[model samples]
Target: MLVDIHNHILPGLDDGPESLEEALLLAETAVANGITHVIATPHHRNRKYDNPALAVKLAAKSLNEELLKQSIPLHILCGQETYFYNEMLQDLDGNLMTLGESGKYLLLELPTNYFPAFIFDILLELQFSGYIPIIVHPERCEFLKRDRQLCYELVRRGALFQINASTLVGENGLTMQRFAKHLIKHNLVHFIASDAHHYKNRPFLIKSAYKYIQKKFSSQYVTYFMENAKHVLEGSVLQPIPPISFKKNSTKH
Candidate 1:
């Protein structure tokens, strides 16, 4: 099954759909795109939005019920896209929700403009605490984009990287798209999620992105990403290959 690990499909939780109608519409779009399952990752502990685990679970349950009523062949699972904070370990130990409620993977977002000096330390702590920190949208982060070695180190340190589908397609911009492709070519990307907020603006583009991956890379690469998503949902250990290095001489400019 095609599973989206990062998405904001729940209503009134964060910067996603505003009402039940919008949520249902996004569900329909996802189903049509051949996505069978999605994790409703509402923002948590961000300065603007803070959706706790229990509340996100309740919202996901309600959305699932509505999808059933509407006959939408899509399932919504509970999760949260938590911003990195000093108290993250404490929060996860307390009541923070991990991706798909599996407790094996946590969707983490870093600050956009700067990479915190303690990021590696936090990631190590998270790994020691038995949670795999999946860094969301590394291609879009200015710091990682500038320093590819940092991304490589994070992956080597047991942290997984998730690339937004839009970033792969240049929907965000060419620079992000280039970095997304760079990560994929080096086997640094473990998951490809929609990070979708709306149907029109930031819709689920997994199908198209996979198609692009198959054509540009190989069918095996597509399977690798899909299988990683499945493993994440099942809370099983992911099979990550050693990442290849991107030679600077191959760049055009």
Candidate 2:
């Protein structure tokens, strides 16, 4: 009943699995982890490669064909991990980098360092342009470490947050794990994704994380995150929650 909103399961396109075999392995791992659905989010803003709209559509088609051939029951959707650069606005405005699964939700990936001032301004611009921006892996972004309020403000400004399951499982780093816990405790996170690239380093861990959260938080919150993800798959707009401020030290609290 869970859906992974971010992943690199597409074969040979990005830094994900290099072959269909690997992709299938990762897909099975995701399914084993209770992920009923996953979004194939490839790198769209890599200048070395062109992730045009048509190209992504084609990749989705190809991936579907492979999945069908392998008979994997997990449903897969299409999306892009968009780089938050100045030119991203142009691509989005022109309809290239827009969200693929829900069509209204675009996944915005910030640089690992402190968020450039322009990243915030441009996210606002995208919202003004009528697109819901899903901030990918906000916990892993070093910018959040610099100023957690920036993250809370993003949620305040009506942006959605997607934390990777790896962060919660402590597969990333201690700081990221702390941030993920903080985000979840404050209810600042709306979705959790695999952001998974491999079956080993980043095996899908939703099942374990689900048990963890369900034990700590209410099952209804777990349902909220999982169901909200399904809403994305069905192309439904997520019901927005009024943003809450961060405690700055929710990790320790």
Q: Largest TM-score belongs to which candidate?
A: 1
Residue-by-residue lDDT tens digits, candidate 1, 1-253 = 9899999999999999999999888998899789999988999988999998989989999999999998999999989999998878888765697888788999999999987989888988989988899999988787777778777788988889999988877798887887788888788999989999998888899988998899889999889999999987888989899986545334421
- Show where candidate 2 strays beyond 4 Å: 46-50, 93-95, 247-253
Q: Which candidate is the best by lDDT?
A: 1
- How close to the true structure is residue 56 of candidate 1, measured as C-alpha lDDT? 93
| Candidate 2: tens digits of C-alpha lDDT, residues 1-253 | 6778788888888888889789889989987887777778888775654566666777778877887888887776778887777766677545365554455788878778766787668778877877788889887676686677777888888789988877877778778887777777777889877888998877788877777778777788778888878777776778856666766633342
lDDT of 2 at 246: 64
Supply candidate 2's per-residue lDDT for 181: 79
- Measured with C-alpha atoms, the lDDT of residue 45 in candidate 1 is 82
Candidate 2 root-mean-square deviation in Å: 2.3
